[model samples]
Target: MLQESHTAVIARGQHWRGEVATEPYEAAWAKEAIFFLRALKVEGSLQGTRANIQISADGIHWADEGSSLAVPTTAGEVTFCRISHFGGFLRLVVALPEGARIQVVASLNLKA
Candidate 1:
């Protein structure tokens, strides 16, 4: 995790180089929030990968807020920016194929 004043940059989870069904990261923010998503270059065998942004009024129940984004499986990078108008909970959901090694970073800015 990294922080600059009110902004926070974090790795959703450990190096997702193993086989996992779904990796979800959650955080809380003000009513109006800014988010940045970036997928680092992945290594090793690659396959179908997907990611999406989700939000919720409560942490337990979440709803997809943005269109499903395809995650680059090869050695490349992808990024996305979003400004949320509702809900106080935000998360990034990523699906990695078996034998896929990936690293994703997320940054959150909370208005003062």
Candidate 2:
């Protein structure tokens, strides 16, 4: 006779965020989970810098989850976008002007 094995995993139910530069950044992969946008922080000196959010299932092809967000050229500026959706994977695609440098951070509330 053959038997099946079962295991249980405790859901993290925690929040996670990733930081990236203007050169383009991708977040870590998340398994069978849902996420909610908490906040976005933009810092550093640059011009016409923007942060774009994207989601993917295989990490090969990506789709824009939302519109491009404008980033302040100056520091001490934060944008709040509270959106919720379920995805197998999530990442960020940043756009910067020529010779522009900026730092972007995204926060997400994870649920299993």
> Mind giving the per-residue lDDT tens digits that candidate 2 earns over 1-112?
4333222221122222233422222233222322222223333344555556676667677778775555555545554333345355555455555444543344443433
Q: TM-score of model 1 relative to the true fold?
A: 0.61
State the lDDT at 50 in candidate 2: 54
Clashes of each: 0, 0
Cα-lDDT of candidate 1: 0.58
Q: Per-residue alpha-carbon lDDT of model 1 for 1-112, expressed as tens digits?
A: 5443366675553467543323333444454555554557676655556556677777668787875556655544555555556456666677566667776665665652
Leading candidate by lDDT: 1
Worst 10 residues of 1 by lDDT: 18-27
Candidate 1 residue pairs in backbone clash? none
> How does candidate 2 fare on TM-score?
0.49
Candidate 2 Cα misplacement greater than 4 A, ranges: 1-48
